[model samples]
Target: MNTLTINQKNKKNAARIAAFALLIMTIFAGLAFGMIHSNLIVMSDPALTLENLMSQSSKFTIEILAWIVIALMDFVVAVAFFYFFKTTNPQLAKLSAALRILYTLFLSVGIYHLIQIAINLDHTVLSTDIMIHLRSFDVLWSRGLIIFGLHLIVTSLLMFQTYKIPKILSALMLIAGLCYFTVHALYWIAPSIETTTQSIENLLALPMTIGELSFGIWLLVRGSRKPFLNATERFGFNA
Candidate 1:
């Protein structure tokens, strides 16, 4: 095959890898951060939060594994996209992938604190330290997500410029990026209005999910250019 054909094949393979990884990452993230974290940690009541974690230790262990899977998948998707788009815009692709790697590194560091909590769970006297670590995880993860927002913006720009994907996908991603950037900025900068920012995030969460989720589904459903073939003729075994 020619170099161009080889590159096209590589991109297709990378797209499939990225698509599958993205879906897995999203599912684990929803379980880890959305369900488990929300159920365990209550910022308003740290002692109660610790009690919840102690009581639901099994679930918390699953949450930690889920987060590890998410970070791993993030790396997988990052590497895959770097190859997939290197031909189109090498510099942007590298930068985007780098940002995601940075985010994943930050997230991994945050998850380490949870591991620590698991290690020291039996030490009830260390409630203060345990809760502090939990808070650190949230803060550190949120900081990482700010960089993730930038990654999304750059990825969306690439999508917008590329004719192969739909423009609406890019638009949705842009919106998601803006929402993440703005809400988190509000959380750190204007702590007094956290409730307001959370409300905004809840309202805009659909776009955030729809952008990447739809893109993943689109990647799975897309077929390469091929001649039409009847089902029976293609397989040739069944009646």
Candidate 2:
């Protein structure tokens, strides 16, 4: 094969690897956020929350394990996206990777609260303190989402400028990022508007879910099908 053919093959392989990473990220995140954590932890009721954690300590531990898996997969996804899109704009790709890593760091720290809850579950004397810590998880996660939203916005902009991904996917990502930022910002800025913010969040869930899931599936299915010879051409730059 000629040099051009060799390079094309390498690009295709890279795209495939990145796509697989995204798929793994999606699966792990779904299990962590949707299945394990959401089911096991009751955010509103302190007594019920403690009882569940204490009664289902093993399951709680499994949830934490799932979260750790999610964190590891998130790092993989960040690196994969950086590698895949670095040709379009290296600086923006680096920024995107950095923001994602920062969000992961925040989530890693936040997991400590969950771990503490598991450890203190058997100690009835620590019940009150544990409840306070449980509430902290919600706050910490919201703050982490703020950073995650910024990462998504940057990633979406990069996608928009590149020919590898669809423009509609980029638009979806932008909408999801805006939803995350707006909802969380409202939650923090005006505690009195909790009901209003929650209603907005429920509406925002549709775009966020569709955007992220569709993007992941696209990456898994079609990411390696075509390679752009001139990545910056779509953005009006010389190859």
**Top candidate (TM-score):** 1
TM-score, structure 1 vs. true: 0.90
Candidate 2 local lDDT, residue 46 = 66
Q: Supply the global lDDT for candidate 2.
A: 0.77
Residue range 129-195, candidate 2, lDDT tens digits? 8767767877888888888888889988988987757889999988988888788888889999999
Per-candidate TM equals 0.90, 0.88
Cα deviation at 99, candidate 2, in Å, is 0.7
Global lDDT scores for all candidate models: 0.80, 0.77
| C-alpha lDDT of candidate 1 relative to the true structure | 0.80
lDDT of 1 by residue, 1-239 (tens): 75556656777787789889989998998999899988888888878988888899999999999999999999998998788767666788899899999999989999999999998887454678887898889788888888888888888886775446777887888888777777777777898998998898899889877877787777767712221122332343211
Q: Candidate 2, TM-score vs. the true structure? A: 0.88
Provide the lowest-lDDT 10-residue window in model 1: 223-232
